[model samples]
Target: MDGSQGRKTRQVVAAIAAGGKVGRQKDLLACGHSEWSLRQAVKAGMIMRIAPGYYALPDADPLDLHLARHQARKTCFSKAAELGLWILNPVPQPHVAAAHGRPVPGCKVHRVKGGQTLMDILRQCVGCGSELEALAVLESAVVLKQCTVHELRTAFSRRGDGAARAVIAMIDPQSQSIVETAARYLLKKVGYNVQGQASVWGVGHLDLLVEGILGVELDGEKYHNTPEGWAEDLRRDNLLVINGVWKLRIPAAVVLYNPDLMLLWVERALDRIETASPR
Candidate 1:
């Protein structure tokens, strides 16, 4: 191929990869690539024929390849994870959506077609996972600005979606991470009115505020492992103490793994705070 032909072929390959790094034969043809060109490109190792009608870049993602081979789209927790959403409990196998309940080996398939929208994935998540899991995914979407809470609520307004709609109502966009979301949910479930991303006079924004008094800081290791992070946190703790605000700094793992213990600690703190209050 000459320089011009090579550039055109590269453009074609880029177009194919743009659509999830895979394209159908008809899609390639639609992009103005002739059959001969496709054959030449395949032979030249630019793209690979993964399935009979599916073509993909030579180094496409394995999940995308699997989805193309099965004629399916990722759904449920799998799709949420793909979209960089928070998942409380990730499943072992891939979760997918296919038309007419077609079975894909080693995958948990949802009976649906064209699972391309975020709403479809959220609905599948609600159907396949627990309520808490659904809430985490929805909040993640909100935090990422992928979709708005109103849009999600509107999508789930149809019949038989009361549960899903309720979960959507619980979404707090200010909950920065999955750990914060889980901790807030647990506190709320136990009848604590938790405010997310609450600001203090001297300490800026906290991860959560319980009953407008106790400031809860959910510490993920990624943010607090560095020396600078440790110094900043200590400074914030000193400020909170000086400001007469009761505070709790709970690690992300403690909230995820031993939530009951976390709740016990909070209860004890609150008890002490109440006892020492000036009447």
Candidate 2:
């Protein structure tokens, strides 16, 4: 590939992997080729046209990710590359990834600066959180930490692709479990009564609720990845029913990407309750 094209391809890739940088010199050096080749591909449209030598996958949505990450210069001291660092080296400042080019001056580039609110967490995170977490607060702001899952979910849908996904992961139906906690500050503005986690004889504590009516559960998918976990979820569901709490399980994927499905499911569940009542 020619120099310009190759550069664009490299840039696109760097863009998609936000907060992640791809080294042109290292990549081409390993392949016995020059970084200039990445530029060639960019011109040919063989790869995404990023800043210079960076490349995002052709199909990767540039709009979904922050295009600016490709503009930052890379630093070798990043914690992930360290041989034996423990505690995950608390997220890098702004958690911004470096790009190949003249550094943009006066830009405060910190890795994972603010992406998440403190509420997503059931409790304070142990050790530290991921760059994605810090980004939550950055993208949404401290006020988002105040809204209910329903309110936040609405706000999250308007974000671009990757950012939208990131925002939703921070809050899920589990908003029900912690709704009251949020309502103490934010939900009250919407005039909704927030309920805290409710424990049943057989079921564990549910995430959050409203007027003791709707139940919401946020699923991170860690449990579904294993067979034992899948079985446990089924068992848990049965226990939930025994305790008279019907929950809407919101998966991280649906919550982040296809959140409307979650809203639909919640609506349907609520409809069932309304239908049973003699109004």
Candidate 3:
């Protein structure tokens, strides 16, 4: 092999690796590598053919390779979840935006331009998932300060009246976790007056207050798994009970995995409270 040809191959690999470990036949051609060089690189196991026009390094990210193979870009909940924004459901299929309309076997195509903005993704996401699921991602984005409320409101304002607008009206940047968002959603769905992050005179702030009487606390492992944390929680629970506020602390796993059971418990508690209260 000529030393210059070998150097060119290495340079191409480095370039592709830097650019998300994927490239195309046209990319190699633009980088001054001949068709013969691409064939040699594939034959030598330097890269793998992702599709007719795309190639990826051997150690490329699986999701990136999948995107390149289908000539699509991740969008909606898919992009939001990947960016560490909260989402309720694990995406059943890869949500992709592509110029072509041909159905890809395992992906949900948005059938548009590939480069979608965060606002664009949010607009699509609200229509794609359940109301709660959509709010979870939207509220998470706001709470994390990924997108400001003003920015989201401005985006929705351009789209006019629809589910996206309804979801925008429901956006609460106060929700700290998907569990909390789900909890608040479930309570409101059942006709309870749910206040998120409600504060007590001595208690600072609680996760939720339902019907102005019941306190619902969402406990995640990171904050509640320690003995000191456990003791402090018990103290808080005792204090709430003393102040005529009954408390129910829901574990994060229970809220996330068995939400219906938690909701059932909540409804039953609400029913009992209503039964006991004077009309």
Give the per-residue Cα lDDT of candidate 1 at 131.
85
Q: Please give, for residues 188-220, the per-residue lDDT of candidate 2 as tens digits.
A: 234545454656566666655644776766665
Tally clashes: model 2.
55
lDDT tens per residue, model 3, 1-279: 579778767776877786668877776787777777777677778888889878889998888787887787678888888788898889899898888866766889888864567888888888789998888888888999989888887778754536766776777788878889988887788788999999987776789999888889999999899999899898888888778787788898888889888888888887888898889
Best lDDT goes to which candidate?
1
Off by over 4 Å in 3: 1-58, 159-161, 274-279
Off by over 4 Å in 2: 1-196
What tens digits encode model 1's per-residue C-alpha lDDT throughout 238-268? 9999999999999998999999999998999
The estimated TM-scores of all candidates read 0.93, 0.37, 0.78
When 1 and 2 are scored with TM-score, the better candidate is: 1
Q: Which candidate number has the best TM-score?
A: 1
**Would you give me the overall lDDT of model 1?**
0.88
TM-score, candidate 2, is 0.37
- Which residue pairs clash within candidate 3? none
lDDT of 3 at 199: 90
